[model samples]
Each structure stands twice: as C-alpha cells, then as structure tokens.
Target: MAAIYMRMLGYTVTLTMHGFNMFLMNNLLQGPVMEDPNIRTFSAMYKRFFTVWTMFLQIFVASLGLTSDYLTLKYSNKKEPYWLGVMRSMKNRLFAAILWPTVFLVSTFFWSLYHYDRSLIYPLFADKILSSTANHILHTAVVPLVVWELVFQPRSVPKSHAVNVAMLTVYMSTYFFVMYYTYLEKGVWMYSIFGIAYDTNICFPLIISFIGVMLYIYYHMQWFLTQIVWQPQAKIKM
Candidate 1:
C-alpha cells in the first residue's frame, strides 16, 4: 500500500510539473511574449507552428492525467472506476501514438537546424520574444518528460495499431495542409526550408515524407519500449 501510494505521488508530481511548465509557457506567449512588436506582427503565423500545437496538446494531456490520478487515489479501496481506466487508456494511447513522437521529432529537428544555422529554423531576431529557458522547455525538456512518462507509468498499449496510425495520419496531414495554407495566406513558410525549395525543388515533399515516415518509426519505437518495460501479455495488446 505504501509503495502504491508513493508511486501515485510520483506520477502526480510529474504531471503537475509538466502541466505547470506548459501553462507558464503559454502564459508568457499569450501575454508578455505577444507584447513585443515583432511577435505581434506574426502572431497568427507563430501560433500555427507545430511546436505551439504540440505544447497545447501536452498541457491538456498532463492536466487530464493529473485529474485521473486524483480520482483513482480517492477511490483506492473501491473497484477502480471504468471511466477512470478509460481516461488513463486514452492518455496512454495519445502519449504512445502522437505526443511522444511529435515531441521527439520537434526537439531533434529544431536543435539540429538550430545548431547548424540558427537563422534557418530559429532566427536571431526571434530570441527577444522567446527566452532561452522557455525555448528549452518547449523544445528540449519535453523530450525527457515524455520518456519519463513512458518508463515510470504503467499504461496499457492500445490494441489497434491501425487506429493509432490513423490518428497520426490525420494529425500530420492537417499540419501539412496548414503549412501550405499559411504560406498562401501570410506569404511566409512555417519553416524556411519550405520557402527555399517548395516551388522549385523536390525537397519540400521529401522532407514532409521523411517526417511522416519518422512519425511511424517513433510510434513503433514507443511500443517496443513499452513492451520491454511492462508485462508482454497483459499490457501490450498489439
């Protein structure tokens, strides 16, 4: 019983921390960060970026997990509620399928481009609006946080790979469409690479295709990791 309670405490603390960081980041972006003239100028475009979208999603999931944890603890002596289990299962699926992959991909690609040439992915002028701390929390800290969730939490893997794949497909496809739509409306590409090669070269499609493939790779990678961490027969369904 003590061990179980301690585990619950750990999960709650982690979720609270994650949720709080995201809330803080969102607050800064919506308030002080947006106050800057440069940020205000491209606010709509910036909001449409993949990082921001993922950040929002992560925040919501963390909040949901925390809530479910609280309810499960409150009813510790009773039969676990079905809805609570469903909430957790939903959270697990989202984490394994969408959140983990997107966060890893964003952090990896952002830092790679940022190091090679900051101007290409994250230009210097942009630094004034997004401080290094907030920047790292968005692009760097999230990687470990998601990994921590996978390792520490006991979660059932969703049985339907097709459903997971479909969810990811819709998510990436929507963002893909939004990328071109943003260019048409704002006359600016979300990533500079698109602006450079989208019209003349095959690089744009190739990059998008590569990202699509990587998403699936990351998805399966999580399943593999989960299988190693949790019981094979009971936890992992597919």
Candidate 2:
C-alpha cells in the first residue's frame, strides 16, 4: 500500500522501501547497543546478522508485493470466481491499511529529519541520508510490514483490549526512551514540539502524557481497521 501510494505520489518506491528498512534495523539492533553498555557486545553481533537478514527479507517482500499487484491488475479481466474476487479485494484492502500507516510514519520521520539537524535524530544511522534511507526502508517498511502481517493479518484473531493496550504501551515507551536518549546525546531537538526550551522540568511530564495519548490514537486506528474494515469483509459470503 505504501509502495502504491508512493508511486502514485511520484516518489521512488525503491528509495522509500530502502529508507524504511534501514530505519528498523538500526533502531531495533544498533540503537539499543549504543545506549546500553550491557547490550553492546552481543547486540552488535546480532545487529550485523539481523541487518543482512532484514535486507534480503525486505527485497523479497517488495518484489513479491509488486509482482502480486501486477498479476492482479493484469488478470483482472480474466473472470475470477466469486471467492477469488472476494479474496483479492480483501488482500488489497489489508495491504492498503498496512501500507498507509507506514508511509505516514516514514514520511513524518523523513520530514522531521529534513527540518532538524541530522545528529539529533534517533536511530543514529538516519543522520546520513544514504544510511537514513536504508534505515527507513528497514525500520519504516520491513519491520512494520512483517508486524502487520503477523499480528494484524486477515486471518489472525483480534487481540483483547488489555493485550492491545499493553502492547501499545510497551511500543510507545520504547520509542519515548529512545527519543529521550537521542535528545540527551545530541543536545538538540529532533521534534520541535519537545524542543529544549520547553523546560524539561515541566515539559518532560507533558511529553510523556502526549505519548500516551498518541498511543491511544494508534490503538484506536488499529482497532478500526481490524474490526470495521477487515473482519466484516472476511465474514461476508462471496
């Protein structure tokens, strides 16, 4: 979905995919190692292996998605059975839901990077454009893509509200900590809303509250996609 949107928006799909992938690998692996000495040695080794694995995986998925889209369009007139049409429509919608948020997040990050000093960005690799693009593909594209597939795919049962909230909390907390670390290390603002002049003495608490609110919004969006879009369609008879 992101690829399609990017293509429609006249951005290079390859570059967008590459940028997102690099972002994920750097954040999940290298960022932790750099911030915590306890994680440095083993985490560094894991990061190298994970980077290679992720690169291959992203390329394969991107190719597969493009091929699938091509085939779907190319054979659209060839009269599919009712079930096939239903399946195809569901697949396409699911792809769109997954793709849209990724593009939103990646575009947001990229725009932020453009406005702020590179040094101030989290997932340190994003500081360099090439590295940042790679990071974006890995982090922004691959990780989220896989996550959507595993956790939010059409056949998967929706998680309970408690579980959903817990998962969302953990995810937001990790991002918040990483952002805080990035701010401390660079002594510059990456996100203008949380700029240094905001007075950490008061602003820090507000920032934390803001993240909680954002997480709630994210969860609600996920719930709406799963419950309102995918599941009802899945239940309809072809």
Candidate 3:
C-alpha cells in the first residue's frame, strides 16, 4: 500500500515538473533564444539532456504500466501467483531492471557533477530551459523516489554488467559524435565542454573514465539495495 502510494506520488511530482518545464520554456525563453538555430537543433534541445530523457521515460513507463498496478491493487480475486500472470512481462522487467537504473545513474552522476561545478554541467539560462522546479525534481526529488523504490521495490543488478556499461557507452558516444560533427558543421558546441578548443583530445577520455567509475558503482550500489530490501524475514517457529 505504501509503496503504491509513493510511486503514485513520484509520478505526480514528475508530471508536474515536466509541465513546469514546458511552461517556462514556452513562455520565458522567448524571442531570440527560442529562435536560436543551435538551441532549436535536436541535439541542443531539452530532450537531448540525459536527465530530461530519464524523467521522460519514467513518466512514460509509469503511464504505460499504470493498469498493471491498478489491477493488482484493485482486486484480490485471482490467486495463482503474481508472476504466473501478465504482471511478469518482459517489458515490465526491462523497465524495472534497466530503465529504472538508467534514471538513477543519470540523476546521481549529474548531481555529482553539478556539485563539483554548476557552470560546467548547467549553463546560465538552465532555469529558463529546464526551470528550477524541474531541476529539483530531476536532481533532488529523484533521489527520494529512487530510494523509495530501492527500499521497497528493489530489483537485482543485471548480471550482464558489461552489457549495461556498453549500452551506456554507446549512448554517450553517440551523443558525443553527433555533437562533435554538429560543431564541425555549424561552429557550435551543444555543450560548453564539447568545443574543439578545450575538448579536443582529453574531454572524451575524462567523460569515459567517469562513466566507467559510475557503472562500477551502480552495479555495487544496486546489489546492496537488493540485499537490504529483498532479504527474507526470518520465520518465527516458536
């Protein structure tokens, strides 16, 4: 019951944050900023952001699987084990196992970088782009929601840790390559750090190093959470 409500609350908060982000961008970042070709580009837009993408998927999966939880909570009539039914679909598991970790990983890493240097990670008009409300929801509130799921609805870290890391690498590499080519073509860096002057040789290596460390930490952290949450209570046979 508590977990359900907590998930519901998280969904509500995420939805509200998304709405607030749109309102700010549409209303505040008007005139020239909105009309900037660089900003208007797909890579330069909000959806390109890892934080925004994770939140978007969280809301998307939550809405798509709403009926699963709804039906589970709505009745107690069927009793053949929850896993025996459609509740245990691959989509649900992937969303739970892969998609969920991606969110936490992105959230955790972004916050770490933000703390180290806000200017590098987020720019001057970040508030106008994502809004303070949305930022907190993505960076701060995301922690609690992640902890809530970890504490209550924990899932194991996937055994294919290498595969997971490779997928994440591919994601970052694609972004980097696209942004790199775009910069070559248009003389604009999608991010401040992506410019040829500073980021030429060392930038990618540094980012890759960070990703490797984070992936290692993610596996261990998730393993710990699963241990703490999913351990069976000792039976009292007295």
Candidate 4:
C-alpha cells in the first residue's frame, strides 16, 4: 500500500513536469517578438518560477521517501505482527545482510573523495553523484531488503514471475521519475547513464550497468528471504 501511494505520487509529479516542459518548449519554438519586451520578461519570469517550483517539489518528494523509510523501519521494528512472524524474521535477516554492503559502498565512496581534486569534486558533488549513489543504495539495496522481509518472505506462498516483474517495473518507474525531476530542476546530471551529452551508445552501457546493480541487489534480497525466512519457517513447521 505504501508502495502504491509512492508510485502514484511520483507518477503525478512526472506528468506535471512533462506538461510544464511542453508548454515552455512550445512557446520557445514560436519565435520571439523582438519589439515586445513584456513578452521576454514574461518568459524569463516563467522560467524562474518553474525552476524554483520544481526544485521544491523534488526536494519535498525525496524528503517524503526518506521519512517514509524511517517510519517503516520504526514500525517494523516494533514487531507488531502486521505480517506473519516468519516474514518478520526474514526481513530482519535481509536488513542485516544489506548493512555490510552498504557500509562498504559508503566507505569506498568517501575514501575516494579524499583523493579527488577539489575543483573536480565540486562539479561531481553538485551533480549529486554522492547523493544519487546514496539514493541508489537506499532504493536498490535497503528498500528491497525491507520489502523482502516485510512483504515477500512469508506464508510459503509463491508469487508468479509476472507479479514480481510488475512490482519491479513500478518501483523502477517511480525511481526514475524522482531522478528526472532532481536533474531537471537543478540542471545537474548525477549519473552518466542519464547525461544529455552522451550518445545512445555510451548512455546505453551506463544504463546496463545501473540495471545490473539493481538486479544484483534484487537477487541478493531474494536469496536472503528464501534462506532466512522460508527455511527457518519450514523447520519450525516440521
């Protein structure tokens, strides 16, 4: 249910951005009237307004996700049995498994930052490379671990492959929408995969790399769910 709400929120924001972009692009292509200073002033105002508005919206959404994550973790940790007991245990194990890798990634990232040139680092940092990496870790690693434990790890119930694919599609779409707004508003390209400068050839490879990372996280979550959640539940039932 939380996932569904998050997906809707993201989709609505994406559509709003697309609408605004279309309006701007159409007016720009209509050709300027040089004699009309008012028109130019209006255009400038519109651009500034939208830029600030979009930035606020993006920040709001990101903060909401972070808040939601905190709430979810807190609620889950209460052990109120919203889901099956086995599922809860599975989630716990999955969360534990993710901690080590998350620590490793953050440690490596910060260590590399120490050796980076200050001038070079500013652009990269401003482009949200660090924040994006953290966001990706949360989405690809942390969220999945939580979902596996909270949602998927109980009842000996097998879900169809299609269901899994649909859920993933929704998740990725939500993620991409948030990222698009983050870049659009700030004019900062975080990952090379989404960089406008690159041709499809280069961009595609980066996208593949991104996908590979997500898949790795997904499978790892699945393994943890199965081993820690299902196996132990099976043993108890035996």
Write the residue-wise lDDT of candidate 3 on 2-50 in tens digits. Answer: 7656766655665666666667656755666676554466324555566
Candidates sorted by lDDT, descending order?
A: 1, 3, 2, 4
Give the per-residue lDDT of model 1 (tens digit) for 93-139.
Answer: 77766888999889988999899988778866577666787788779
lDDT of 4 by residue, 54-79 (tens): 33333343344344444555676575
Instruction: Let me know the TM-score candidate 1 reaches against the reference structure.
Output: 0.84
Which residue pairs collide, candidate 4? 91-149
Arrange candidates, best TM-score first. Answer: 1, 3, 2, 4
| Candidate 4 global CA lDDT score | 0.41
**Clashing residue pairs found in predicted model 3:** none
lDDT score for candidate 1 against the true structure: 0.74
Compared with the true structure, all predictions reach lDDT values of: 0.74, 0.47, 0.59, 0.41
Query: Candidate 3 vs. truth: CA RMSD?
Result: 5.3
Q: How far is candidate 4 from the true structure (C-alpha RMSD, Å)?
A: 13.4
Among these predictions, the greatest TM-score belongs to 1
TM-scores of all candidate predictions against the true structure: 0.84, 0.41, 0.71, 0.34
Model 2: per-residue Cα lDDT at residue 225? 54
Top candidate on lDDT is 1
